[model samples]
Target: MNYNESLEKLLSLTDSERVSGRGQHTRRYDLTRMRVLLDELGNPHLNTPTVHITGTKGKGSTAALIASVLSSQGYKPGLFTSPHLHTFRERINFDGEPITADEFAALIEDIWPVLTSINHDGSHGFITTFELLTAMAFLHFERKKAGFQIVEVGLGGSLDSTNVVQPQVCVFTSISLDHTAILGDTEEKIARDKSGIIKDGCVVVTSPQQPQVMNVIAQACQDHGTAFVQSSEECTCTLSSADLYGQNFDIVAPWGEFSFRTPLLGAHQLENATTALVTLQVLNELGFTVTSDSFARGFRSVQWPGRLEVLSEDPLLIIDGAHNPHSIGKLKEALHDYFQFRRVVYVLGFSSDKNISAMIQELPYDNAEVVVTRSRHPRSASVETLASEFSRLGVSVKQLDTVNEAVQYAMDLAQPDDLIAVTGSLFVVAEAREFLLNIPPELYPSLDAGMPIR
Candidate 1:
């Protein structure tokens, strides 16, 4: 079968095994099963130098930054992230390019038989869908002989499938209250889970976090005998020209200083940049030697999608995948700082578990017209429920059953000088961009087209 066809089959398998493979309803967090599976596959995750990134807000962006830096240093970098916006291939990439269909199918096929044995062994439980994807990425990176691999944790780092790798540098972006049902309700609790990626003797890099969260990471580093570096105390990022297109910033860290301009937005990205800079510094300290020129090249060429992505100029169309409250708060700040419009029209949808009401409340536009919609996901929140929540905020709200309808409604309501921002969930932004903005589904790889991932 072809790439798309194969991927569809793979997804079907995941759906079929959802009752056993997915941990959505359970509190199952065991690495033994995945560890056994990885051991069976020869532990491909151990074959490359790695940087493991974890956090609530900026882990994805930090991973992109670190990978870009590695690429600039003349290293064939491997990047494994999650929840692809358009295509499944987006989850695994090398040197900033998605893995080819042929390679993906071959890799998955090679692992399928062994994976079945491990899954059916009953020694532990079944392998999760994410665990299989992690295995695929590791195997591909090993086969390609990548120099460095950037792996973003799927959820709480402690038991995340990607945590199987022993990373040279462990980076934690800003921690916030999210995934309370799984990670816990308190900031300290979440921080402790995120700090799980901090391995013994690995260099830990992080931005200044809440005092409570910082304590948790500091304690973890101490327990592991790891050197912990904080961005606010040990690294500084000065951002300028952070507009709709991209950003220019200077990252000064304990190891050295470098300046770079990236195709990402928001001052919040500076924290992500700081984390990456420290990771690069640690890489150099570990004999990687990523020089100043390489630093400039890497960041300048770096691209992420969806985060404040400018889709149009006439009506000022912007799309942000701010599914969580913390990310939505950052989106609000970016919008307020960068652009001004006569009117704002928000195209919003979210998953059922997300605090959609809190997101709408925190978004910058109270006076902006709101169009509530449902993303093409099994867990999407109903448009009417979201619309009613927005109504309580006294915002003029309209409910559209689908993302496409919401996009059309916003576009029709928007004037030449007005702005239409699509957000709430990555799925919503992806579906809207694909169907409304005419992005071919196959080519639309990531939500973060030219932004930082964390």
Candidate 2:
């Protein structure tokens, strides 16, 4: 099959990423099924030096940073992340560029027969769409002869499809209460689920987390006989200055002290940078050639889109995918620290399953004008639902049916000194970005280009 044909067949399968409601819990997320599928595919995930990362937030950014460092160290690194904002090919990249359309289609075609056979057999149960994508990524990385592959966990780490590989180094970003209905309601419960990525005898790196959450991760490392390293204890970051464009900071790590200026915003990113730096340090100890100069070059050049991304300067538009309360709180703090504005305009959208009430409370909407809208995503919450939630919070809200409409309305109302923030969901931020940046579908070669995944 061709690229478009293969994409159609892939979309025809059941995609849990686009599904909503508690029924998601009923679907099996078994790693055994994933293992069987990979085994049938010749176990492509094995014998690869991998860096596995998982957490509630900042894991994607951390993975991107690690891949950047590996690339700087003269290694061909493959990066696999999830829930692409603009294109499906964004989920898979080698040496900072997305896999070409032909490459993606070739991988899909290569795995089609095995996927069909597994579905036809009853004992193996049907594999998830994500599982197929994971298998395809492993095969693509191995075929391309990547020096290292950086994999990010899709959901809870234990039963996640990407858990099949034994990583050379494991990194965990901050853990928080997200996916509560599926994972658990408390931080400790969620931490236990994330700690599942810790493998026996591997070195695990983490950012500073809550004491309870830290205890859970530490206990998991002990159980697996893995060495745990905390970024906060091993390194310290002091922010010298920050603005909407980026931030400058000094990191004192075990190797030595280094200063970095990054286009990625927020003080929270300091933790992510530290986590990536420490992971690179661990890789160096494992006989890798990453040096402080590599860290310096990579840390400054990494690009993680849609997380505190500043798109425009005239009206000061910032788009972030802060879907949950914990992330929204960080977004609010970043906004306060980065920009000086006369007024703030919040263009908000969220999925139906998100804690809309709690997320709204965390947003800095006390003195800001709120515009509620829905993205093109199937699971996006309705404008009426969001408007009602805003009203309940004693905030006046303007309801718009689509993300583009909301962003245009905010722009029309804002002054040059006012800030316009498109947030609450990555889907919403994706739409706003396309509209504001005037990106055309032709910009990406994939047939499914400019389409939001999940």
Candidate 3:
């Protein structure tokens, strides 16, 4: 099939990311089916050493950092992430470049026959859109003969489609009450589900977590006889300076001490950088030839868009995908620490499944003007719903129909030195980025254009 046809076929499958509560109460994932599909295709995931990362936050950033470091060490690493900000190809990358459209279409064509054959009898159950994408990534990595692969878990770790690989290293970033309805409500329960990626005799690295969450991970490592390394306990970071452009910090790890200046802003990013450093140290022990210079170069060049991204300078437009309360709290901290503005204007949109009340409470509405809006996604929460939540919290709110309208309204209300932030969900930030950057529609098609905005 061609590019558009392949995209259409993939979009016809069950995509949980767009449809809320699609399989919340059901066991939608089957690891056995995943393994069977891979086995039929020669199990390409086994062709390269892999690093598996999971958590509620920082998984994407950490995975990118690891891939960048490996690339600096002269390795072509295949990176697979989830829930792309724009095109679907952003979910798969090789050596920091997205897989080209021709390569993606070719891979889909090669796998379509196997996919149809497997679902012909319906005994194995239909593979999900995410599972198919995961298989495609593995196949592409094997075909290119990549030096390494970095995979990010799309959801809860244990039953995720990407969990079939026997990774050499497993990393867990901060865990919180995200995807609670599916994974579990409490942090401990979510940590249990996330710790499922720990394999016997493999090295596992993690960020600092709550006491209960840490207990769950430590016990899982013990049960599996895995080596557990806590980044917080083994490394320390001190921020020297920070601005809207970037931040400078010094990290003291077990290997040695190193200073870094990363374009990724915020204090939480320092923690992510430190976690990546510790993971690289483990990889070095596992026979990788990564050096301190490689780590320095990688941190200096890593790029993770839609997370505290600065788009313009006149009115200072910043966009972040801080959908959860914990991430929203970090965004608030960064705003206070990084920018010098007379006023702050917020353009916010969120999904229906998020903790809207808690997220609204965490927002800086006391000192900022809030504009509630809906993105083009089908699962976006209505502007009325967000306005009601803000009003209930005694915060004044303005309503807008679309993300573009909200951004324009914020810009009209802001002074030259004021700061305008478009946030709450990645879908919202994506729309705002397209509007502000003047990106072509053909280059990044609207995945939910015809759907209702509210």
Task: Work out the TM-score per prediction.
Answer: 0.92, 0.96, 0.96
* Tens-place lDDT digits, model 2, residues 127-146: 66677789888998999899
lDDT of candidate 1 over 196-279, digit per residue (tens): 888897999888788899899999999999998876787778875666688888866656776788887888887777777777
Tens-digit lDDT track of model 3 for 1-454: 7777777666555667767444312235678878888999999998899999999999999999999999888899999998887788888899899999888889888888888887675576777778889999999999988999999999999999999999999999999999998899999999999998988868999998999999999999999999999999889999999777788899987779899988898888999999999999999999988999999889989989989989988889999999999999999998988888978999999998899899978866656888999987878899999988987888888999999999999999999988999989988998898788885333313354454221
Per-model lDDT: 0.80, 0.86, 0.87
Q: How many residue pairs clash in each candidate?
A: 14, 0, 0
At residue 60, candidate 1 shows an lDDT of: 84
Lowest summed lDDT across 10 adjacent residues in model 3 is found at 445-454
Give the distance in Å from residue 311's predicted Cα in candidate 2 to where it truly belongs: 0.6
Looking at model 2, how many pairs of residues clash?
A: 0
Worst 10 residues of 1 by lDDT: 445-454
What C-alpha lDDT does candidate 1 achieve relative to the native structure? 0.80
Best by lDDT: 3
